[model samples]
Target: MSAFDEFAAVHETHIGVVFLVGERAYKLKKPVNLEFVDFSTPQRRLAACRREVELNRRLSPDVYLGVSEVSDVDGGPADYLVVMRRMPEDRRLSTLVKEGEDVSEVVDRLARMIAAFHSTAARGEEISAEGGRDAIRQRWCDSFDQVRQVGVLDGDLTAEIERLTLDFLAGREPMFRRRIAAGRVLDGHGDLLTDDVFCLDDGPRVLDCLEFDDRLRWLDGLDDIAFLAMDLERLGATESARRLLDRYAEFAADPAPASLRHHYIAYRAFVRAKVACLRATQGDAASRRTAREYADLALRHLRAGRPRLIMVGGLPGTGKSTVAGLVADELGAVLLSTDRLRKELAGRSPRESAAAEYQRGIYAPEHTERTYGELLRRASELLAEGETVVLDASWIRADDRTEAERTAARAHSEVVALRCVAPAEVAAQRMRERHGDVSDADPRIAAAMSRDVDSWPSASDIDTSGTPARSLAQALRVLVD
Candidate 1:
């Protein structure tokens, strides 16, 4: 075919081989015995090949065509193969995230798809029992043991991770029990990193559902998505990950606790490190370095970083939220939007029309004061818990900026103010072009804010009239460093 053999390319994963022949691909299960799975025999590998097509079809129905038996060994009925269509490399979600393509819309659709998948996924006594408190603890503890036995990670870091995981799981037994009783456990897509997902025009086609072991596939739906979430965090797509979790929780009506989120993120990071170590043992040089990197990521997840308060402020349409979103994602900090908070507080739809004049109606000074106070309250709470936070608001008044500084002082955190500035003409144009935004700043309000804007000499000013990506990179250099 095309001056070559039928198979044009070969790929090797930890437990499988893939042969890419033109637009079609065939996967062959590796005959090996790992700690979590056994595919040592041809019969077992064949069954796993069938299971791979069967389980992954639930997520990527169009991509996973079917199973095939291909004979390339000793001219006999030999190795089993999974035949499917191959997508372009650029369409992968991981690639899009790395390339900084705007995939916010795709992430929304992804959350919906995952939520729907979990709703229809299998859940019963058998599955729920496997997702019980003890079972979940055992799974994390086993991960710790495995990573430790691998002898690749730092000893003190491992001890600290084990300590944190054990303490969190032990303290949250009741929550796990409640989740199990609620029948929220399911046979989910167990390995949900970005590499296995494709963001096609239709939507995301998720593949690789960890089919070798059924026990590994059974999990709490939250735990299932956390793998992708953790991967997103590591990829510096933190805001997208946050939005995905929030949308999924809102859609599923199954909000996970902050502690549970931390636990699972650490677990997923450790698991990533373990997988990288496996690749390293097989003489993959890049994976050898990646193993340590993932281990360091796990260590960061297991421990709390120094708390800081990031202030993103600007007149309307200077792209405060855009820069703050990037800063929050890079730091994995909590993002609080004043516009969303105001809409929430006013008990009004974000799209509802508001014809308020300057400091009139719900935009009155009293309401403004209350919103700022509540925002600071929330920031203080998160900071007190040793989590960094980013507040997206217009710090027009010097008094309000002082209040934020005082709040950070009380919480024992430093305040970093990033004032986004665009020329008056640019800001005016942006306001006129704004659509479908949560912010209620019309051109009139933006003009009013611009006229009344006060200068903050101490604040670092970032010109945001240029390209958003380059502007954000500049802001991150200041905010993160």
Candidate 2:
């Protein structure tokens, strides 16, 4: 009764209740202990409130005021509250996004602000461990088990998502170590939803970081930022989400692989799906639909993050390297050339010529097999690590092509085969004019190899007789198709 009636509205969450009054908000931790959070005692709740104020001030200094306590008539402490200066509800980013407002500039500024915050965030061994593969896998397992216990989502969909997530994490130990060494892991905003961001005229104020658990707050900066990105995509602001990530990458100088970004975003989506499922268990019918949507979004991101193995093959002087380069640039793929790999295996520089007859020298059948074997071996490792690979080689032999396909299958990846071809005169002239090139093949070698080449029925033929632009366009079309 003590100023309880003064609150215009009261919002209750699973772990806390917020009282919204004139120009102020008060948060009271609920007396509950869940599997993830524990605020069952007054002392613990007060400690949490103080921690929230101390941490949130790092971002929204002017918003979090302090902690206050209410007293009973008998002069005993009744309850504690986290007092905050209420932000403008109408200026919330989620509201603006739902109203169809253009928030490009807002997102840009937000990304920069987040990057700066992360630049000065706390980092050390403890924080870095949360970004490692084992920690990530454990958190994923926790979410999966929680969602399964709720039994709100279809078991099969949940199982598939879990499989994809675990498989992706299995081979990322090295990448995770690289991230830790590069100082990409830190204590970041754990719950960066659009609903908690206020876009004021001065700047954007982010609120409601998960202060209850240090483990939740300590994570890779990319995973922290992906929380908001995932929410923005959920709100149908796909372009704005992309803009935010691009700006963050530019501002933070983060060179994270695209697959890792997608994976983290997917993980965040699944976490939200778990929460939605919990809400559905509490009898929120609408949340059931939202849970499915989030789960499906997670699945979609998982599929997008899967690695690809693209084989660009053709006889020498068919412009295969050119096409492969273009494709790699377009797809952000790692390009590996048999021409370079072969020379490397033979202890020769790429430009060092090893001219020999067909099936002789470095081009010998035995040597060629070794080169292709090494190529596929390297590609397999890369694919396991969630990288798209473009192999620039003459995959004219059926055995090597089959081996590449098997490698991709082992990695749970996709294989794309492209065969480049040019007119006889064009190819001959290209081989004749070749200089400082890694390939040792001449027009004579090419003609002999052409006669001996096996039929390639599965590869998409890309004619390189036209302009390079035309050839690239054709190859891209084939790739997308």
Candidate 3:
């Protein structure tokens, strides 16, 4: 019998028959044709099998044995297959995530592993500006076309999605080009979905990189990160997704790459939703039902609008910052404080600046301008990505409130201007007892507070003269309800 029949005699699947020969397992790719990928010729299949083995060795050195020719008949080579050290099937991330395993640790481990992998991977020196843009654009177009072919999407929903996609693309293309010009694109494992990750006892391993096409593998690091993040979110691991991103940014040690994070995330979400919708129409009955569920989830998240932006506006010592933190924690939002921004900009602690009388620089017109600008920028960006943002600032100026309102309006998001007010005596007493507070505004500043400050927005207002926890409970009711 031929070697193919011999392998088939051992295994069940005729296409890509997997068998154990000695200590290693051989995976042979059948000469099959797929819509996106093709292995039509024996030589082509052999080359792909060899590429998989070679590329996988970079990450899973112990698992990828090598590639070898497997002749159909004795002494006559007809095809080839990849040989690998068989791993415990349960070690796959998909299986672990399904079992409600400790995915946080697994994802965190993946972040570090991917970081190391990207740092060492080769980057294309000849990546053209237009070439990168076209590649991204083409991916989106092809994905949309696939969805169109499925024919399950309604006309109105498809049109709305198309509009949103075009809007984001138009605005983000310039930024993407700038990032590409700065060499943010590098050789990476293009397909980093959960199924491709293996959680071993030692750590996590990423395999099955895009070895055939360098163009697909060569991309902005954010794209790879987004793929993983999107997978985590889809698997109902939002917290794990957040932790993975946090760990990645911490280990990467550079915030420059973070600017592109939101854009990549949105793109990833869009593509994933599209694919899910397409599969709903094309898959088998059971799979199509599951795909419909995924599509509904995606649509809900897409239409949920940006995360709520809460601006805590009040005079000094009204417990604005404390209450803001509580609300942020409860809402799973980012807490942006003017006090922290001030300290970061001045290179001095709030107390030190207060003692030196040089702290006025933190609230100076120019510095305050910078702080508010950064806060609004971050808030809008996060909100657009469906993340809540809590802005803790005095918001003592009418112009500041107006600017924030305009930002929310432009982003099609909601803003809750929370006004924390307290009696003058109460404010002073709390500020005087505050020892480690980060705000430069002193208790004495409470006495100097005038009544001519900007008017609070007509939105919700909370009186913070009572216990902070109580005040936060009230705010939470308004936010969550």
RMSD of each: 10.7, 3.8, 6.1
Cα deviation of 99, candidate 3, in Å: 3.9
> In candidate 3, which residue pairs get closer than 3 Å at backbone N, Cα or C atoms, i.e. clash?
none
lDDT, candidate 3, 1-481, per-residue tens: 2222232223543346777654457788878877656788987898898888878888888888788887665789888878776554567787787788888778878888877776777666564442365667777677667767776656566556555554445434445666566666777777888877878779877767877676777787767777788678778887887687788767655353232454456566666666656556655456454544444444444334334668887888888888888987876678899888777777876556543232255565688788889888877776554456789988878888889988876655567878887788888888788787787677655544545476665657777878878899888777655
Candidate 2 Cα RMSD after full superposition onto the native fold (Å): 3.8
lDDT of each: 0.81, 0.91, 0.69
User: Comparing 1 and 3 by TM-score, which wins?
Assistant: 3
Per-residue lDDT of model 2, residues 426-454, tens digit only: 99999889888888889899889888788
Task: Name the top lDDT candidate.
Answer: 2
lDDT of 1 by residue, 56-133 (tens): 989888898988877765878777888898877678899999999888998889889999999999988888888887
Residue 165 C-alpha lDDT in model 3: 50
**Candidate 3 — worst ten consecutive residues by lDDT sum?**
1-10
Any idea what lDDT model 1 has? 0.81
